[model samples]
Target: MRILFFLAFFISITCHGNLIWSKTGHRVTGHIAEKHLTRKAKRAINDLLDGHSLAFASTFADEIKADRSFSKYSAWHYVNYPMDIRYEDSEKSKYGDVVMGIETCKHIISDKNSSREDKVFHLKMLIHLVGDLHQPMHAGKGDDRGGNDIQLQWFDEGTNLHRVWDSNLINSYGMTYYELGDELEESVDKKKKLEIQAGSLYDWVHESHQKAVEVYASVEVGEKLRYQYGYKYNKLLFEQLQKGGFRLAKVLNEIFS
Candidate 1:
């Protein structure tokens, strides 16, 4: 009961209020792209996919089957643990949840007994979780299911804190997934390439979690945001989405290679 109370209270604080929008869904999708490989990575991917044509969900299912530990959780489960804090106030904050996620992925991947498919599952999960870890809200601390409990009026409809960020923000762009991906692909180059490095999953999550902190800090209590803000942030959102996809692809390619 004590733990339940604490969890409930925390949930209210983080989510039941005004906090809205997160990058979880887009990041998850992006991670899907990140883990899909090309060329030599094919064999590893084949073992991972069990002979599927390499679509996103198929790869995800393969990874899940490989890693039994993950069965305790789900594809959308939150990452565990936190990392270094640059700000004292943020020390108690949830900004580094992504770091935890990356580490979790690493742990599963490195286990010798882990099946090829499970390694693939962990890898795919890591890719998606890394994307979630980056979303400022997923790194949320103080409960609120990362602010899912927060209620708000998004575009004149009543919504919760989590839903707005999970899908609504991207939906506002009015672009299909393919269209968004293509537009972002056009912007990619050597510079963007340097932004996402090939490293431990924990490192990637920490990077995003840190950014999540910055995002929450920028908003105010009860501030009603509209189109201008969305437009300004759209590019950033797309970039994250694209980065996740490309990085996912790169990571999977490496493992299979």
Candidate 2:
């Protein structure tokens, strides 16, 4: 029993440390995009997904991590840039970064001769990558492995800077993705939505990289983060998720329209 308990604890710690946005955050992005998608995009997406909603489809990229064959895609979730360099000026990963992954997925889905199976796979990837792109840590500098190495405490529990932004703050609110999606939708008006959706993909990526710099400056290693931390950063969290959703809709609208 003692050995079993220690192994279980070890696995839990290992898994928790690497997770990206809590499932809730990704689903919220998907749900929000669903609301903003044009009629043509909606129909095309439904047909490609066999009627799966964007919220459900949003998780496919993460879920595939369980299969070793998909291991090559692990790097697709984030892009790293040094503080002094723009992504355009930085060295890109040969295995593919978030930006490349998103672009490739778009190209695949937009090709008329692509197989249905290929289109479905890339569409799911597109949804998930867009959400990942908005996660500030996903734009982290390579030195810290996107803040994964910046260990910290979350309400005194062992965690890290990457996990905190990925899920800790959003999960602390105790809202399901659907609930959060509704709340976000209510909070933003059309003008704000348009503003958030503005900018090219590179512009959006640079925005996230800037936010990542702020996130790194907000705390130090071993800091205990709790209510006060959430209070300070929750608004930024919502804005990123909202922007991700809106921008995803814009991308899909352009592709399927």
Candidate 3:
């Protein structure tokens, strides 16, 4: 009983959502998804977003964080599970998690009985959450609050492990979302695209968790990460953004097509 109580207490405190990718990372996924979307999916998105690009609509979920009424979504940005445990074998967050958020968005958007307003809202959230799912830090273990507590410095500026992965590396690379997305498109030929799009959402979560393990190993608490860290991780960074884009396209295509 004591162990069960302790576990429950730990989850209640640790599973609060962490910030996801920076605006640029989200936009890269959105841009790549746009290129790969089917004609019907594009039309549906156009109607829902009033012709805005997916990149334009990709950050709605984060933008609403300032509003108190949107507080229910605070826990929907990340999941809590043990590092070595597969997500299916771990305890689930009672408040909700990214998987639940994605499923909710899908249901609302797909239901013929759903209100147009509800569809629009959920679709926008879905776009952001899909990209959120790819940011491996968001999939990090809950004990450290998705690495937000792992304080460090980026080029001597104070930051945390989560922020470094969320924005610092991508920001330091200094490419616009368009440039990054274009490069990814050129690099991903048909076979690679197929492989990227092949996984189920569950598989993607497991994949991110694996990456998170490496991420947690990359630095000690209070470590100062500099140019060398960025150099080493840039490929992983780009791969994640690219994977996110491909998977998001697959999801939107399935939903709308």
* Per-residue lDDT of model 1, residues 1-257, tens digit only: 99986776566434322322233344334534634456666665555656653335423422343344544434243432243453222443244334444556667776778877668666665655545544556555445565555656666776654455556678777766556655666666757665664555545555556655555554454455568657776665665666566666765555555
Better of 2 and 3 by lDDT: 2
Worst 10 residues of 2 by lDDT: 11-20
Better of 1 and 3 by lDDT: 3
lDDT of 1 at 38: 68
Better TM-score candidate (1, 2): 2
Per-residue lDDT of model 2, residues 109-152, tens digit only = 99999999999999999999999999999999888999989999
Task: Quote the lDDT for 114 in model 1.
Answer: 83
> Would you give me the overall lDDT of model 1?
0.53
What lDDT does the true structure give each of the candidates? 0.53, 0.90, 0.88
| lDDT score for residue 6 of model 2 | 70
Best by TM-score: 2
Mark the 10 consecutive residues where model 3 has the least summed lDDT. Answer: 9-18
Provide TM-scores for the models. 0.66, 0.94, 0.92
Candidate 2 wrongly placed segments (more than 4 Å) = 1-19
